[model samples]
Target: KAVALQKLTYLSSLHFAPVASHPLAFPAIELIASPQLPHRRLAYLAASLSLHPASLSLLPLATHQLHKDLSPSTSSAANHHVTALALQLLASPAAAAAPDLPVHLAHDLVPHLSRGSPRAIAAAARVIAASPSAAVPVLFKPLAACLASPDPRASAAAAAAFCELSAPPADAAPFLPLAPDLYNLLTTSRSNWALIKVLKVFARLAPLESRLAARIVDPVCQLLARSAAMSLTFECIRTVLTALPAHDAAVRLAIGKAKEFLAAEDDPNLRYLGLLALGMLGPAYASTLHECRGVIAQSLGDADSNICREALHLMMGLIDDSNVTDIAGMLVSHASKSDPEFANDILGAVLSACGRNVYELVSDFDWYVSLLTDMGRNLHCAQGDEIGRQLVDVGLRVQDARPELVHSSRTLLIDPALLGNHLLCPVLSAAAWVSGEYVNFTKDPVELVEALLQPRISLLPMSVRAVYIQAVLKVITFCCNLYVERLSDSSKEVSVALNGLSMDQTVSGGSDAPIGSSNGQITVPRMMEKDPFSLKSVVHMIN
Candidate 1:
């Protein structure tokens, strides 16, 4: 069996998930209760792998052996390894997943968290997390003392234990007393890992106790300035960004550190983390973000997508009333040159920013409308639904913007090339609807009619084609109304011209014919020729 341990280990690795009825289950159980030490260890290893935590019925079989292994060795035979393995089993998915740990085992388990072994302490914390009532009165003080232990291993393990306790924040009020201990570890412990865990706990704890924030701010700043470990530095920056925003000095220091992260071009991890940290800053520190816009812009093209995404996120934050026009332009431009996926990401971010709160950041609706149109024309543009919604929404909500909206819509609808792009179908539909609904705003209704009736529109889905046809009808109606109004005006002008002069004057002018059609208004045959919805083009397209 000793020589076969490797085979057993390999076999254990094969079944990653637990199976209650695994063939080796019963042998492993008996091996756990065996007098031989090697058998017990191997049995524990095998059981840990295949034992489902929900198998409470099997508890009777192995509980006694586990309790015996976990219990303090009475003589010189104390094997910390056996005790460690027992704690791990209990801490793992097995007892960790247990809803209510058997109360009897709490006696042996509580001592491990206090002072037994570093490995044991951390594992005990995980197991006790399932039954937290066991930790406060019995193990909390000893665990806190371990955080102050000179050995970094003990302190880190204790910090890990506290990290678990300080989660969800509401339940974390119990760990408020550990803040002074966490702060000590934060300042004195050279272990970056321990410091990170302590910072994490503080991130949750700082809000619960405001005074702890003020007290920990100085040490956190020192760590930010002094620590070369980007992970630890980023944690300190996060602590400041999330928990201590009111402390302006620390926030500035944190933001400065974040900029350094952004500037780490060689390390994409640092760049991504830097962007993440900067994104947490509020508008009050926009100037800092603005100053680092160059680095942020550079991040948008980073080889790593996480960096790109975070870069995009922070870039969107920089958009406001004053700079949105510039920012939107830059993003849309960048999107065009990018691959399709990131291109859409850029388009979406700008759309959300400019369209947020009903385009709250947009002052010049005309410019924004044109921007939407340009985006719709982008080669990789697939943000048609959003673009379409905003287009039609602008036409509906802002009467003054309709003229520009119609102009932009005309640009999109006229492109027969765009009709085949199913992604752009929504955009084209919106364009058609906008052009027709705001036909009065259109300077050239005939051109709009031509665009709406383009033959390639057959490539559009039925729903979109219906919208296109309806738009054509609206354009026709608008043109008809305009023609009638102009006709009435021309007729009135002719009447005035004839009455204003004598018959001889009319006869001398131009063979005694009325000059109404020649005056300047659109005439019938000319209108028909220019209109694509006219009889000839419509018939040709139908045929």
Candidate 2:
């Protein structure tokens, strides 16, 4: 028996080596059937390493050996190793493929949860956790009892199983009674691994149970502060952020700790977690977010794109009416220096944020126009085009409120240097629309017209040239209508003044004579009207 066990150990070791041969399945089987506990343990270990799904012929014998090891009369040491191997086999794809195998294994493992050694109990809990829902109800109460075990491994495994089984709301109700114990473990447990497991279970439960969510916050926040493990701290922060309400004091504590992580930690990943937490809590803590602004803005220039993107998103969320200009300026600066892909992301985020909050942001329209103009002047064509599109959107949205700003936009759009820029299409389109609609408000219509019809207009693309022509036509027509209205009003005033003068003369009994005429015969000044044909000819010539 000792020789066979020795051989099985050698075979198992060989199976793991790079150039190892196939396991001696026949020899392994002989050892598994042995009555000695040491021999059986080694045999099961060897089989687990060597047995493949193709070795279907050994299924019956393996099943028999597992049952023997799990039997109530089995020694504790033997049960520990055997149950672990059994659970491993049950989790294997080959065992899962066998009809009724998981069910039978789950049935045999349920009893061990109460009576087995710690290792065996943990192994049993893991297997049961993976079992179907039909096996959960029968196993839940027994597993819940293991949470009180002095053995931390057993308790942790039991907690993990509870999480798996109680995934559904209806199934989770039975585990509610254990919440206090779980919270205690989360707060007081020495093992980081155990605390993480418990925290996950609570995170999952928190969403369904609001009271439970509130209860877990303080513990989770405490963990975030004290835990040095990056993974653990990240998980704790995420739990608090995702599970708790923003107004909860625990969430505030978690955000405070997370900001520390972002500032103090150099790891990009931890910083990412920190950024995520701050983002979730930023709105609720807006008054205090100024402390994090420099950190987040600096992160926008990080070497890692992931950190940069997260920081960018958080920065965008923090922007408001009072801070749009500063935030927008920062973004434009970053976009100017970033790679094309990241620059695109930055530009896109700015446009989206500003567009959504345009009503609140329009008051800063002049600064925004200048920013867009600078961007167009500095960026490459593709990026510049993106800026131009945003500029056009901003222009159209703000025109009704600040029509005077259109002149500023017009000056930028019609620059000789900017006129030929292919990226200026959207800008020019917006400018044309603004000029045509608000030309009357322009202080110097002739200068505005000159800017619109610079020599560069002839060099513009056909589409833009068409737009320019239409805008000029609208301005000209408006000016003509104003001229005609003013001319008619002036003529009516003159006619009324002349009639009043003549009436005064008749009352004084003096000879009536035209005001400008020296002869006795009364003469009226001829009201010469502008020739409609001549005006039409001039318009036709301009066209």
Candidate 3:
């Protein structure tokens, strides 16, 4: 009786007695103090643990004597007070921890929660959230009954409490048949707040619980397609993405349609959310890259920089094992022509694709080399250093490009006697770990060592000699580690060796011997067991 509580001043003012012993003292004090706010104060007091037992002893009499006399108008306020007191009581640690208390407290709990204002209803939800098991099927009944109540507040509160109680449990699957009711609320009323809250609760429930994902995906997709409540659509997108990973094939199949649907969407907000959701669905659907590629490519040219950034991020996720080469080609084409920000995005993507072993991207060697040089001069100026550094690493992994790299850096690293100097510097540091799985381009160690040892070449300035030696070591290591086949459809015995030596076991010259040269001058050198250039001769090469 909030009305009575509001009317009784003395009842509202009674604070919890400090002494635990005076159970009988509160009733006499409440009787004298009961008037309007004082009654609310007393109800607040009676709700406290120290005074709980004493107040409970008198509640039966008070409910019968005082509450019965209240008219319907007064009953509403009285019910509010009673509901508040009930919630406060349940929240007490003493009541919760009492070992002898029966688990089924919902019989008494239902009426208090089902009646009263939103505050009381929300308080009841908190108590249920605190201890859900003790208030289940019983709480559900009146909550369902109140959902149809004439009072909007009662219906709203009932919806809130029902959502909390029905939140998915690890031990119990959410009863899916009830979804229609929730969906009805979301669709029938423009109560976006209530709908959003309910949807969130549904989303929070574990994904593995039956067909919940399917149920939400269709309805949400409709909302998204119609551009109804864009934020809710975004939330639905997030919820579906999160849940679809656990869905059966039928669900994934249905979810796949969202990409096609979103591709046609004109609303930037929905399109943005769609791209994100599609990106999140990446590994499961490689075709998504191709599907979104047009949109993503278009976004790169968008007036807004954030659109470009997001498009690049999506491109990174959607690029696949099969289509990566095409993607890299696209990136490199941009870089080669000096497209401003796009060249930078492609450079970063190339490095990432290479580092992560997205082999399809590695086939565009010509473009790859050009991008490397472009990035080499400008990577430092870019926003992300790690991306810049990774670009350099990709550059170092290039076997076919070593000659180009050396040629470009000739003034700095490839001078005649400068083999031992830091020709590649930090690039070589990354090169030290790069594998030769795909390309073989390194110079023969024996040839490099011999070139360095020649008296005329060795006599150059120390700085020049040091540079040669560094080049010799880098070349030798590169040749030694060569693993990927060098020859492609373009040529035979052409070893585009990376990180290792290229022997080209099959000779391009038709035979492994000198070509028809039985002349006295031409000769084949014999293999030496101790030759550092020999495959078995190097011991951890530099190490």
Better of 1 and 2 by lDDT: 1
Q: For candidate 2, what is the TM-score?
A: 0.60
In order of appearance, the predictions have TM-scores of 0.84, 0.60, 0.48
Candidate 2 lDDT over 1-543, as tens digits, reads 457546656755666531113345656666776767677666666665545545656667667767766677755875666666666665454444443444555667667677524544554444555464655666566767787777777777676656655665435566678898888777667887778778777877787788887777777777777778977887787787777765367766777778777876557777887887787663556765677888889898889899999998888877888888889888988888898788878877776676674446646676776766666654443555455566556656665534545666567655778776676666666667667767766555545666777888776788877877787787777765654564466776445434433543211113323332233323222231133222222232244
Q: What is the C-alpha local distance difference test score of candidate 3?
A: 0.49
Candidate 1 per-residue lDDT, tens place, 207-320, comes to 888889899999999999988888889999999999999999999899888877776768888878888898888878878889889888877777788888888888887888
Which candidate should be chosen as best, given lDDT against the real structure? 1
RMSD (CA, Å), each prediction: 6.3, 12.4, 14.5
Indicate the worst ten consecutive residues by lDDT in candidate 3. Answer: 430-439
- Name the runs in model 2 displaced over 4 angstroms: 1-86, 89-105, 108-133, 161-174, 204-227, 233-256, 282-284, 368-405, 415-428, 432-543
Clashing pairs in 2: none
What is the number of backbone collisions in each predicted candidate, taken in the order shown? 0, 0, 58
